[model samples]
Target: MSSFSIRLYKDSDYEVVRGLFARGNLEHSHMAFRHAISVTRNWLFTLVMFLIPLCVTGSVILSILAVVIALSIIWICSRYVYSYYVDQCLSDDMLNIQKYYLQRDGYGFWVAESGGEVVGAVAAVPSSYSSEDKHTELKRLTVARSHRGKGIAKALCRTVIEFARNRGSDAVVLQTSLPQVDAWKLYEKMGFRKTLIIRESSLRYRIVDFVHFRYQYDLLANKLL
Candidate 1:
């Protein structure tokens, strides 16, 4: 904390906070889980709607109306279900950071210039989120879009991992999406390996994106040096 001087996020930094969450890794597991629940709910709703209507209505025109109603029910319920979990968990990184600081389970770093304007940001969350051994999820890593390719992302990543190590984490893990091809590459250079390859989609995202590998190092072993 002394090296970077971290503090809880203030209300005024909402926009920057939003960008941080928006910019973090997007996991396919989340999209896949949400979509599965949504699709299953819709299919079940359709069955109930049509089967129940059969008990009273027998006309062909009525049957067509039932089909339309089923589709509508599915769409509305899917969005509702999606919103519910998002409120419970930060499917986005920035909101997670705010929640982390608010709950005191996570930490954020805002790289600032000597004059005190923020230039980059990163966040780390508990690995219980991943259910692995003393691991931490490194997330919401971003440099301003204009500052791309200046190694700001690398610096932010280093900061977050160091923070995790200090917190006694076994290693750092991240789940990234297709939009961050460069991040995937960077993780590779930093010694992360693909731990899981989920082919199905999960929460919020719909595209066929690949979940990238996780990187790790033993801070305890290094401490002996």
Candidate 2:
């Protein structure tokens, strides 16, 4: 296994880590789009609706043209909508890492380095949805594609979990989508349990229900036993 180190985030590492976050997420966008296409009934309905007109009119050329237009619209819209969250991460969190994480109490950002180069990152921040002080959120867990399966991601996750425990947190929670199969597996392997799942219901973005899974690791559960 390739050796790596996890350390606190520094201002100098901002740009590289930001790029990694964007690139890593874009890699998964293709899978998310594919899942949406496969599971969303709306896409099938749209195709059928457009085909019915061609069947009635017996105009093969118009039918093909209509199908092409419908597909174009679906593809374009799905890409844009799904990319919105990734864009938000860059705009809100990654770009303002210091203000959002380092500057706050009980919040931290970490980067994994291999051979003196940053290869992965993860963050633990106070959960806004939870009223308990012991609840922290794990976010932005990412690893470079070239360095994956070398325990880099697992190290980053452990860093966040250790950080949370050291700060007296009762639990560390995270959200991952269905497209991130590898990440979900890693979390489960690390003793994180699936606590809840959120499914998209909006009609406009229904093609990619954008399913989100919430996983949590209880820091005190083992100690209390």
The per-prediction CA RMSD against the true structure, in angstroms, equals 8.7, 2.5
| Candidate 2: C-alpha lDDT | 0.82
Q: Per-residue lDDT of 101-200 in model 2, one digit per residue for the tens?
A: 8998888999999999999999988976468888889999889999999988988888887888888899989988888899999999888999898887
User: Which stretch of 10 consecutive residues in model 1 shows the poorest summed lDDT?
Assistant: 203-212
Q: What ranges in model 1 sit over 4 Å off? A: 1-10, 20-99, 106-116, 201-225
TM-scores for every predicted model? 0.54, 0.89
Candidate 2 Cα outliers beyond 4 Å, as residue runs: 222-225
Give residue 120's error in model 2 in angstroms.
0.8
Worst 10 residues of 2 by lDDT: 73-82
